[model samples]
Target: MPQRLELAPPAFNRRKILIHTAAAGALAAGVGVPRWARAQSGPMRIVVGYPPGGGTDRAARLVADRLQQLLKRTVIVENRVGAGGRLAAQQLVNTPPDQTVLLLANPAVMSVSPLIYKDLKYDVQKDYVPVAAVTDYDFGVAVGSALPVKEVQHMLAWIRANPTKANAGVPGTGSLPHFFSLMLSYMAQVNIEVVGYRGSAPLITDLIGGQIPLAFDTLDSLLPQHEGGKLRILATSGLKRSPFSPTVPTFKEQGLPLSAVGWNTFFAPSTTPRATVELLSKAVFQIMSEPETRAKFTAAKMVPVAMTQAQTEASFKAFNTQWTPVIRRSGFKPES
Candidate 1:
């Protein structure tokens, strides 16, 4: 019989062909790319504007801890507290994009501060890129022991009756809380005397300890005192009641439909690579969606408001646009 012939994958020639094909695919992906790319290789830093133990600092730390493990890198939160978180924010802009420097800041740092500080060194929108919004710092209107008001309805009535006794403490001279207290008064048709303190910490301490009769403060910062029975929650600043504390109704529930409070978000230097920005955003959404992250935020009384990149950008622009008129109306004159 004639010699039988069989066909199979080529021994050495076929192996080279396979290798070349794989290399081609990887080239389409990126250089140094494996079938499954490893995480970024470097120590990472998340910069926070405030000192440790405060709500903003605490929130930033929470994210840093989970993200360090998620990205398989060393993540440290550097406390750059000063000028109401301005120093930390400015630092992010100046840092090299490749360093992975990020600002885990609240909305005030992004929105309100610039309006008040006439020559703010940094323009949050122009200087920084939006990473991912963590959540809103939900607030509540509560009276201290020094005041004789408890329920939202009673507080409204008292404000109308004793206009002079309606002095309330806000975070600072031109803070969101300041405008918020003013807006609340406008909606309630009452004259509210706003008193400014250095920061939310002192304002909150006074409110609970009865030095100030009323205040508008972050829910995360105020929940502990409310739970400790040091203050009485008159109304939550949310449009609707929070599931965390169902007993305390929302402002709308008390017939104050104007929703005014503070919020927080994450940002990166505008110069950061798009790949890095997208990577950070993807990580943020994943972390926020995690069960443990949700649980921690819920316990802290933070109300999450997830936004797509486009949406957050539009929102930032809208906030910047709208807040100008609002600031002018609030009797704020930016220093010359």
Candidate 2:
């Protein structure tokens, strides 16, 4: 059983004591006490699967800072970086259902890892419950200045014209960008090679230096360079244009049958009580709905989109269903 804190003491007297006793009896019968009435009080943690400074980490910190104010508890962000977020996810799975710990995760860890990893320790569906949807970001395809292509059609044509220089850089192997690149090639009828890097820094470094002609990564990471003319954004991997780069067209608009939108979401251990989940979900929705919060995320190149708990679960289910087939078709296998 989870520990509970007494918020206040009842006044000592026969009449007051009778009222307190009656209230206790009702709570014991599971009648009138609200779910949050038993909420645990302590320092809360928001775990990030990746190291600090990445988009997910930044978002986690942003939420943690606001959550502290909303919940009136000390909220901390913990980084358990490894295995592409699997390590941090497993940690959350093993934690007690006290609702004091949550994982700030992305689709890469929740939806993609299950499809790719053969020896994952925790089951995403069975071990975790969706709490809230945080932010949605689209991937952008950019070409270095050295590359002559300025649009999707031009880039595809350039790939056909110069087959040897048709390789694209992805931030990591088996990542959304990696598979999106594969889908792009499949749809465009072009054979562009994929080269995976440790993270976006090195990938963007080589991209600007002409080491790689094309790169695919989150719009947040690539939009700055695109604005500075260091590179050209051909298309974004969203059904609609990104608010941060509204001038850029989506792959679908550019005639490619591909769209990849990723999100940052909150999750708690599956065993957590429904009331606890609802409490946290409502808190997150309130935080994300604030105009200041929305502006902060927007300035960070992330779109703030809050969803109800049911909607969050439905979105996760829909995303998982949509990506499973795509992952299988990619024929990607993790290294032992």
Candidate 3:
């Protein structure tokens, strides 16, 4: 009887058992694999803070459309409009760590709003991570047919001469246009009233109708009218001349010593895995780098930009450092 063959059951080591159990639990929660890998089953969403047909919305749609083709998955743009993009940002912050949702944010929501809104729901630095910057745009000093000016210097002189009519309409208060207008007036030693409108549409209407002598808005907002002869863009706020309107000199070129540029950037919740962010960043860079995409953005008056994740983060931090104190000193408060 081979008694030795009937060996006792193998010893059960507690440590080995526990280790195996923990690893099994981790894998059950989908922890070992990246969240984005598991997220591929669901449709990806790009949240736009603004309404449809707006610049931010358009940029989101462009990225969404191409990303769908590249990934062979469904992509949609969700316009979570309100509070000048604050609501959408807050919503994003509250969302659990997910790779399927992203936000298309503007400079106002990222740089200026946080500085001004004391009760803002989300902290731009802590709540979100920059994925990529899709488009870069400049502000334009546009004048209606009423103002007889062809250049920024001439426009400043006219504002100085006509003190009663020294007013500049802005798309919104606490916007780049509003701050830039104030900076322009201060640098040029003029007293131009900064008027805030509901949005670019109304401000542009006033400009075209000659109700407002001059307006400060995005180049894309004013470029069509500027080209249509409904208004004249005296100067653009860029370090260099815009390719869309190359003849138009920049504020720096015109000796104003000032320039401000804005961008539409994609951001994800801070908890999102780095691998997920890299995946989306690579897709955006590829789409924006394409010649056809560049042409489309150019036609829409937005300059296509293909910045890496690190570059996008650097640009965002730089803007916050550069503009926060300036905004504080300006004493311009948003109308809550």
Each model's backbone clash number: 0, 0, 0
TM-score of 1: 0.79
Tens-digit lDDT string for candidate 3 (199-310): 8999999988889899998887888887888888989887778788888899888887776677889999887777878877777766776667667877776777776677
Which runs in model 3 stand beyond 4 Å of their true positions? 1-39
RMSD (Å) per prediction: 18.0, 13.8, 18.7
Ranking by lDDT: 2, 3, 1
Q: Note the residue pairs that clash in candidate 2.
A: none
In model 1, the clashing pairs are: none
Show model 2 residue runs off by greater than 4 Å: 1-39
TM-score of each candidate structure, all chains considered together: 0.79, 0.84, 0.83
lDDT of 1 by residue, 41-74 (tens): 5677888888888767777888888777666668
Question: lDDT, candidate 1, residue 100?
Answer: 76
Off by over 4 Å in 1: 1-41, 199-211, 300-306, 318-324, 333-336
| Cα-based lDDT at residue 44, candidate 1 | 79
Tens-digit lDDT track for model 2 on 84-120? Answer: 7889998777677655788889988898888888889
TM-score of candidate 3 relative to the true fold: 0.83
